[model samples]
Target: MPDTPHLAAQPALSIFYQLLQFRDQRRKGGGMEAIATTLTEQDMRDIAAHYATLPAPAPQTGGDAQKIARGQQIAQQQYCSSCHGAQLQGQKHVPRLSGQSHAYFVTQLRNLRSGARADMDGTMASAARSLTDEEIEAMAAYARSLP
Candidate 1:
């Protein structure tokens, strides 16, 4: 709980500013847009630095068993483990859902559910489309309960 949200969001804001600057420069006949479209080594370094600074969410335990079971059922039905791993530890190019901040998970899930977050494969968006808000909450809770 060292206010990781503020620190994590800074890079996102910086990226947004970088995008705006690139757009402005492109409008002025600058080729920054092409460069900006591709993620540079420095951009990857910056992102890695920010991720390293972030503390993993606090470990959770002792949630309603029935709700967790139901959530697990939904997860299985949707084959969430295919990308998230058997324990939700996450796979390459996928993010860890278990042990993530509840607020963060909720926001992202909502975005995915609503098609606000543009996913490349659209897998998450399609999975989320079938889930109700209550199911999302239950899923989040179940994930939080895991290590």
Candidate 2:
């Protein structure tokens, strides 16, 4: 059972609970580190199914072209379009960034840059780590302006 009821609404929190359970078990004589090293096929399947149920985000639009163009240059140089989509519609597994709240985007980017958030591909973390504070601000601003 979760320590807090609010966590019940978050599947990721449940996953983290399971991970903690595995870690605790490993500390004992359970010795299942190898098995706990990665997610099982069932775990992956369940997560994918849950992820598919997420509602599609609403579109957002409008921003200065010059600012967006500068952001686009940074994005292109970073090859962000390869995963985020040329139009910022987002691709498989990559979360929709366009239309996301600027503050949220900036926070997540900072998390990735600071190693506070574990990016699946390591590419994002590396890319974020290379970005200056100004670049992150610009990217977040541009992403928030996309439709």
Candidate 3:
């Protein structure tokens, strides 16, 4: 399962921020500066907390269970869980692979493998080095099978 609450809240922060702005701007001519000053750490945390209630996303892909199995082997051998989490559902700052499109997964892996995509520390790039295109496809298939 994913940290759905955080994922859900990440996209809605703008709305909560805007509400904060409105509440803070009630005085001082409603200036942006005043609104900025009015925003407390607690206020931000409160807004972020709203999304912690969302449910996890559903599984997105099916078929070729063998490909998924092979992908699992590759992922394990590559030590992917060290960063992406044990299930590849992602952790803080890492995007979930479970429900992503296969094309997206393949493209990202290809880019990362080739250094066309930017990784925070080149870890993905290095991990992707030994992956063949077929392996990438298998990994994508496997990732889609996760919940």
> In candidate 2, how many Å is residue 88 off?
1.6
Q: Which candidate comes out best when scored by TM-score?
A: 1
Q: How does model 1 score by TM-score? A: 0.66
lDDT tens readout by residue for model 2, 1-147? 111111111234333434444544522212444555576656744754564456544444666667667778888999888877886656554555665667667776887898775655587788788898888878877876766
lDDT of 1 by residue, 68-132 (tens): 88878877888887777777755455566667666667776787888765554678788788888
Query: Which regions of candidate 1 fall more than 4 Å away from where they truly are?
Result: 1-40, 49-56
Please count the clashing residue pairs in each candidate, in the order shown: 0, 0, 1
Query: All candidates' TM-scores?
Result: 0.66, 0.60, 0.63
TM-score-better candidate, 1 vs 2: 1
Flag regions of model 2 displaced more than 4 Å: 1-65
CA RMSD of all predictions? 7.9, 8.7, 10.1
Ranking by lDDT: 3, 1, 2
Relative to the true structure, candidate 3 has a C-alpha RMSD (angstroms) of: 10.1
After best superposition, candidate 3 residue 105: deviation in angstroms?
0.7
Off by over 4 Å in 3: 1-54
Against the unseen true structure, what C-alpha lDDT does each candidate score?
0.63, 0.61, 0.64
- TM-score-based ranking, best first? 1, 3, 2
Clashing pairs in 2: none
Per-residue alpha-carbon lDDT of candidate 3 for residues 32-89, written as tens digits (9 for 90 to 100): 4455566675776575456534554556655598998998898898888676767886
